[model samples]
Target: CIILQIIPSFGLPAGLFLVLLIGIDRLLSVYFPIFYKFKNVRRYLMYHGLAIICYALLQYSFAYVYFEDRNVICGPPEIYQGKAKALWGSLSFTVIILSVILYYAVWRKLKNTPSMANDHRLFRSILAIMGVLILGWLLTITMFVLVVFLLDWRGLFSNIHLQSL
Candidate 1:
């Protein structure tokens, strides 16, 4: 159970970093086509992987501090609280925002190119996928904010127990 909970602490940021990297790749391909064409993508991908691992480890360290004696099997009530949760949410939000900006820039550049008309369908599909992803993250962020500000952590468990009975 602990492993299940801890894995996401590492995986979540790693996944977000990958999305950010994808956005960066798209931005570069569109904004600097000549440079991007000859770039060593394999090397850049390796660098991206390393950077993701480092960031995930850093995120996991923050989680480890609050994980001393917490019971994670119950739900996010134990995992998503305090400074660690705040820091994670903020970092994830920043990544999402940056991705949105990068993708938008790519879209604008592609739209302005008269010869790239055939790529619109592909770009639209990508936009739809990204839209859903961003919406899910927005919902998650809202849930965290509500849990932190509106819900009383102690009372929450009691209410769940009462309702279950």
Candidate 2:
């Protein structure tokens, strides 16, 4: 049960970071095609793999803050609240915003470069996937912010009134 709870806490931020990584990969490929192509594959993989490991460790620290109390019910409504939720939300929001900027830059670069016409399909697919992810996160964060502001935290989490409705 604890592992199940930890899975989402670990996965959500990691997944968001992965999307941002993809954006970075696209941005570099578009802006520095020669450098990107000639870079050693093993070195790049090693760097990115190390980055993932470091990021996971950082997120694990944040998760420690959130899970410090060990609530009886391990769901979001029970576990996520106040400062911990706000911190995670802000981090996720920042990643999404950065991703949008990166992808937009990539799109513009791709559009202006007639020489790279053949790569449009690949860029389009990445753009599409990121678009869906961005929208989903926006909606989720919007609702979370609304819920946080519109109702008292206790009412939303503890009272059981929301479940009735």
Candidate 3:
């Protein structure tokens, strides 16, 4: 119970960072046609690496400055918490949406360009990675959400019993 309260002090930010990174990657793929055109795969990777570091910094800042305290409490403001929650929920779902779009787009293009057989191998790898990423995140979200809800339910039940007594 106690840890649950403290966890989002770190977890939400980390998760958000990942969500953001994935979002950026998708954005680049969709909108930035020249994204990998420089022939410098290393630079592409470096930029991606920078995005990750940016996420880490922002995540830590959000956790420490907004959520954490010395008293080991875990909570967000009644109103603002909703906003924060919405941001994450929305971001995650958007990623899922983009995943669907990407899958379809890739499939469609590959189907149209049958001569690019080697490209299919690359597509398979990308799909596999994306699938794994999605599953991992879903599991993580489910675990955290369930834990939080159950703890809250227990707390609520305890309070109810105390009041009844």
Candidate 4:
């Protein structure tokens, strides 16, 4: 029950980090080739480290999210019921959607560039994962929403439900 919080706590940020990484990398490759080519390895590593920290913050944010004062479920479904569903929901999926669009754009643009080489493959893989993530989240959200509404309709969800992220 309590462990279910781990899904949004860590999942949102982890997904965001990947989305940001691939999105930013694709943008750099297409519009800032020179800078991308000459980027410092140390800076690159630091950037990734920063991404990691961002993920951590997002994960821990759940700790402070609103939890329902009372609830009913086999597990803690109401743990993050109404903190701010729209914000976190948008944040999680927006990154995924953007990643998909950005990767495809970069890939099409770089298709003919000889320099694309192994990097193209990287983008290809990113694109694939973006698809997977997008699909996974979409399906999960759809089911969760269906359940939420079902509970709400049937008067299963408690009034005390709350969450911020």
TM, every model: 0.78, 0.78, 0.51, 0.62
Name the regions of candidate 1 deviating beyond 4 angstroms: 74-81, 149-165
By summed lDDT, which 10 consecutive residues of candidate 2 come out lowest?
A: 75-84
Could you tell me which 10 consecutive residues in candidate 1 have the lowest summed lDDT? 71-80
Better of 2 and 3 by TM-score: 2
lDDT (Cα, tens digit) per residue for candidate 4, span 1-165: 335565556554665666667677777867788998999979897888788677646545553464445544623223444654444554555565666677667767777567646876876787687767767766776566555444555432443353322
Q: Model 2 Cα displacement at 47 (Å)? A: 2.0
Candidate 1: tens digits of C-alpha lDDT, residues 9-47: 667778877877888888887788899999897998899
How much does candidate 1 score in TM-score?
0.78
RMSD of 2: 3.9
Q: What is the lDDT of candidate 2?
A: 0.73
At residue 105, candidate 1 shows an lDDT of: 87
Better of 2 and 4 by TM-score: 2
Query: Would you list the rank order by TM-score, best first?
Result: 1, 2, 4, 3
